[model samples]
Target chain A: MDAIIFLIFAAAAVIFGINVVLRTHPVSSALALIGVMASLAVIYLLLGAPFLAAVQVLVYAGAIMVLFLFVIMLLNAGSEKKSRGAWMARLAGVPLLVALLTILSFVIFRMYPRSVGVKFGSFAAGTVERVGSALFTTYLLPFEITSLLVLIAILGAVVLGYKELD
Target chain B: MPANFVPPSGVEYIRVLPEIILAAVATLIMVLEPLTPAPRKRALGYLALAGFAGALAGAAAAGWRTGPAFSGMLEVDGFATFFRLLVILAGLLVTLVSFPYLRREEAESGEYYALLLYSVAGQTIMVSAADLIVLFIGLEISSIASYVLAGYMRREKLANEAAAKYFLLGSFATAFLLYGIALIYGATGTTRLNGIAQVLSDPRMAPAGILTGTAVALMLVGFAFKISAAPFQVWAPDVYQGAPSPVAAFLAAGPKAAAFAVLLRVFMTAFAPLTGRWLAIMWSLSLLTMIVGNFAALLQTNIKRLLAYSSIAHAGYVLVAVTAHSEEGVQAAMFYLTVYVFMNIGAFAVVAYFSRKGERYVEIEDLAGLGVRQPVLAALFAVILLSLIGVPPTAGFLGKFYIFQAAVKADLLWLTVLGLLNSAVAAYYYLRLIVIMYMKEPGDSLLELPGMAVSTRAALWTSAAAVVVLGLFPALIR
Candidate 1:
């Protein structure tokens, strides 16, 4: 059952990821990215990292996707134009990409054989309580510093987007 | 659960007192901006300056402590204090230089000063960060504020272009850094520097292998981009040329120094065991950066772009110190940064002063006959330029001297020779600007000189004096 669930989410993730790159219009690509992120969230859940799965959906798929859509709309981005590059680039690129992918898959298979499967409950330390405790205790400094980062982002948007005061 | 998991406490807040003071003051300035009238906006600059002074004092007071804070996510060690003071000094100088320019542009707002303080706050956090995640957050805070500051003059197309380009390239570099952090975390299952150090030291726990190698390389790329080192330094010239002069000065000095601070800490502490592997890479990067930066700087006619390339060359010199990977090397790098803040910013302040309204006088030729028109300003500019050329009795000279000495002590004789040769090449362009100011005749089209503002003059003279004082008394930094 877990294998089937993993396969479905993983396949969906791969398809959406490809769609994100292949789609020409930025809005379409943005939506495809959301789909990919959501599928990754499901995969995270299957790996027993429920807190990470929730954050993946909430932050990446929801908030970050909205941001991408906003930028696309604000910029009024049209479909990407075709470049007039060397034909040699395309000729070399495709074969090189395929070779790189093949090598990566070969390395992955060699490292982790099929006999060592990732059962859902085998490593179940990623609970909300555990994550929250760790974040406030061990990760408190970074957690507080993130507020300053957000404040700077807000200041950046306002300073850049606002009109000059008379 | 591990034994040393301390709960969040009030004392942790005290450990970060300087950051808290800066943030609170920044927020106060922002809040007061909307309430105050336009003519009273100058008060905000004074207010920001006061806050920076307070924070500097706070950092000095806290410098006595030397240990990790907030459960080892941040530290208050000697190194952190050193960078904290340097960052604060840069902020203070930048705020001083920004006053007249902001008023002249009619863009003086609370947000400008607030962002400066906030950026300094971020830099402080960065130098103090003991965890990779904390360092990244601090980096984002500084980068974001700097992007806004770069484009503060929103009406200018150049400012907008600089901001856009900086944002795009900076985010790409940050992604590489984040990915590298993720790889390191995966290998060691911890983002804490000490934890990673332990893991790397113990082969039974985690081997020094391909994952660590790739992670270090990726992180170095990110750091190199931030510091504007060679091959990844394509953005510096454009961004510096386009951004406001004070912002460009701050960018060249403050964030670059802070980036170096974090780079030294992260590489030295977490990857100490892997130094034998990464030192060769640092050596090559130092060599390439020196060659490319100095050579590229020679052809630049625009003053800002020339300084931009010079900044890159300076980064190369600092990288030589990093390549040494010794205690003396780190100290030399810190000393170089301390001197760099004064001379570089002093030079840029003069650029901002002469550029006048709308930044119309940025070309190297714009400085012609300045010696005849305003002798004091021209003389100060010459002093600053001479310092940049690493001439004797200037801060830049001692900075290069110590760095090369440290390199030679570390058996980097070839790198030292190459660096000295690059410095010789760099001298030609810097002296060219000085020659143009003093030797060349004034053109009929020269803009009428405006009277210097008191604040701008103070900033220039203070930085000039600082260059001489720090040069003669190198023990001040020690």
Candidate 2:
């Protein structure tokens, strides 16, 4: 069942990644990026990183991506018009992406074998509770610092967006 | 999620006092900004400066405590303490420089001061971040505030362009960094720095999984962007040239310093096992940044653009020191940063001094006859220029001396020699301004210093004094 879920997430991640790159509108690209984030969260869930998956969805997909969209909308960035003058110049980025994907595939192959030798169940399942325990008990400073970060972001947005006093 | 959560054994408030103070003060300043009158807005700047000084004192008081704060996420030791001091100093210099610059230009200065304080608060948090998540948050806080600060003068088209470019690149970089963090988390099943360190150090932790070399390289790209190392340094010259001088100073000193502080902790403590891979990459980056930055500076006519490239070259020097990867190298990097704050701030102060009402340009030829008309200003300029060129009896020289020694001790002789050669090439540009100031005839419409330029002069003198004093006694800073 876990393997099936992982496979589904893997497929979605690939689709989302492609959409993020292929989309011409910055807003849609940003939305597709969030889709990529969500699928990545699902992958994390399969890896037994419940806390990380939740934070990934909340922070990356929820808060951070919202800011990206807000800024995109505020800026009102238009969809980039397809350029006709130099197809090769624009297509240069495609080859780079293709190379990256090829390298990624090689890495994935190294991580997995057609006939798997190791059992996935043998690994310890780190649940959300264990993560919270580690965070509060062992990593508490960073947690509070994260809150400080949120506070800083709020203050930063206010300072940037607030009207100047007359 | 809460069931298995066992909170770290002890929670300590003293460990995080400096950050708490900065955050509280930043909030206070932001809340009070609207209430402050336009004429008395200068007081807002003073208030922020006072808060920074007080926070520095608090950090000093909390220095060298050898325990983790809020679990093991924050290690409050001499290392963090040293960087906190450096960042606070960076904040102070920026405030001093901005006061004169903002008052003369802006119709509203309150939010400017408030944002400056908030950015400083973010930088403080960055230096003390102990986890990848905290580091990312601190990075965003600094980057976002800086984004606004870059385009603060929205009326100017160049400022708008600079802000736009900085925002686009910064957002892209943050995405890469966070993705890298997520990949590391997926592999180790934890985001805690020490946990990842432990997993990486473990010989049997499935290096084939998230421990792949690609993740490390991706993360390096993220940090390299922040530090303005070559190939990733495309944004520095444009952003530095277009942003307000004080904001540029803040970028050159504060945010960059915080990035290096975090880089030291992240790379040295968390990713020590992968040094064999990263060291080679850093070696190439240092060499490339040195060559490209210096060669580019030699061609620039605008003083600000020249300094921007020079700053990039300085980043190369810091990278070389970082490649040493020892405690002494860390110390040298911190010291270099401290000296850099003075030299770079002083250089910008000189530029601000020459800026006229409604005039932002600092052309190289404008310096002609400056040595004759304003002898004191000219003398100060000479001192700063020589220092920037790493001449003796100035902080810049000692900074280079220490960093080069650290690299040589690490047996990175080639890097040290390359650094020395870059310094030699850099002298041509630094000295060019001096030659124009002292040798050439004054143009008909030489830029005149405004009545309000006294504050800029004061800033210059203070920074020059720091360069000289620190050079005279390096132990004072250490």
Instruction: Estimate every model's Cα lDDT from 0 to 1.
Output: 0.88, 0.80
True contacts kept of 2: 0.51
Clashing pairs in 2: A133-B5, A133-B6, A136-B8, A137-B7, A137-B8, A141-B70
Which candidate has the highest TM-score of all? 1
Q: Point out where model 1 deviates above 4 Å.
A: A63-67, A70-76, A85-117, B1-11, B444-446
Which residue runs of candidate 2 sit more than 4 Å off their true CA positions? A25-79, A84-92, A113-140, A151-166, B1-11, B64-66, B209-212, B444-448, B452-455
> What docking tier does model 2 reach?
acceptable
- What docking tier does model 1 reach? medium
* Global local distance difference test of model 1: 0.88
lDDT by residue (tens digit), candidate 1, B274-317 = 89889999999989988888999899888899889989999999
